[model samples]
Target: MFKKIAVPVLLAVSGVAAAAEGTTTTGVDLTPLTNSIDFSTVLVAIMAVAASLVTLYAGVAGVRWVLRTVKSA
Candidate 1:
């Protein structure tokens, strides 16, 4: 009898408490100075990744062009 009456009230209170105290961590806090990396190395890596992406895009475009031509012929 008491449990039936208290359960809903307790659930409602817990929900409100969780809403009030939402401890969400903002942004990624990776490594936190555990590993040291050179700025130039980072830049070079970024450049390499960008070049790879462009090369991939060109390859895909070339394949699409070849497929379209073959289909048309």
Candidate 2:
């Protein structure tokens, strides 16, 4: 049942794609827009620093808890 429905749908989609193959305009220049400043590196660095600080804080808290537990016992 699904095969019957899917075969016709696939053929229709291929026909439409073939019809649209040569309709695109190729006259636009996009080099300057694509060469703008890269901010992904800076964003990744900021995220790494933030994650390091959080890990450091968690480690310090865990050590302090262990020390307090030992002192009380």
Candidate 3:
């Protein structure tokens, strides 16, 4: 409907405006050794934490299911 078309239209207009800006037209300029710490290593650590939380939640859910089944029998 209108909602679906409106999103794309707005996105296209925003993209066009961004392209008109010289900064967006050209790629970002960055120098090497700008930071003391590597960002990639931080990202990997965050991902590992998120994965561990997911596994923990799944294990808890399974345990709850087993207890519920036992109580019903």
Q: Quick one: best TM-score, which candidate?
A: 2
- Weakest lDDT window of 10 consecutive positions for candidate 2: 22-31
lDDT of 1 by residue, 1-73 (tens): 9999899999999999999798666856767564565588889999999999999999999999999999999
- What are the lDDT figures for the candidates, one per model? 0.90, 0.95, 0.89
Could you arrange the candidates by lDDT from highest to lowest?
A: 2, 1, 3
* Candidate 2 structure quality by residue, lDDT tens digits, 1-73: 9999999999999999998896777867888887897889999999999999999999999999999999999
RMSD to the hidden true structure, all candidates = 6.9, 6.2, 11.1
Q: Write the per-residue lDDT of candidate 3 for residues 1-73, one digit (tens) a residue.
A: 9999999999999998888774545666565546655799889999999999999999999999999999999
TM of each candidate vs. truth: 0.49, 0.52, 0.50
TM-score, candidate 1, is 0.49
Q: Where is model 3 more than 4 Å wrong at Cα?
A: 1-37
Candidate 2 structure lDDT: 0.95
Regions of candidate 1 where Cα sits further than 4 Å from its true position: 1-37
Query: Which residue pairs in model 3 clash with each other?
Result: none
- State the number of backbone clashes in model 3: 0
TM-score of 2: 0.52
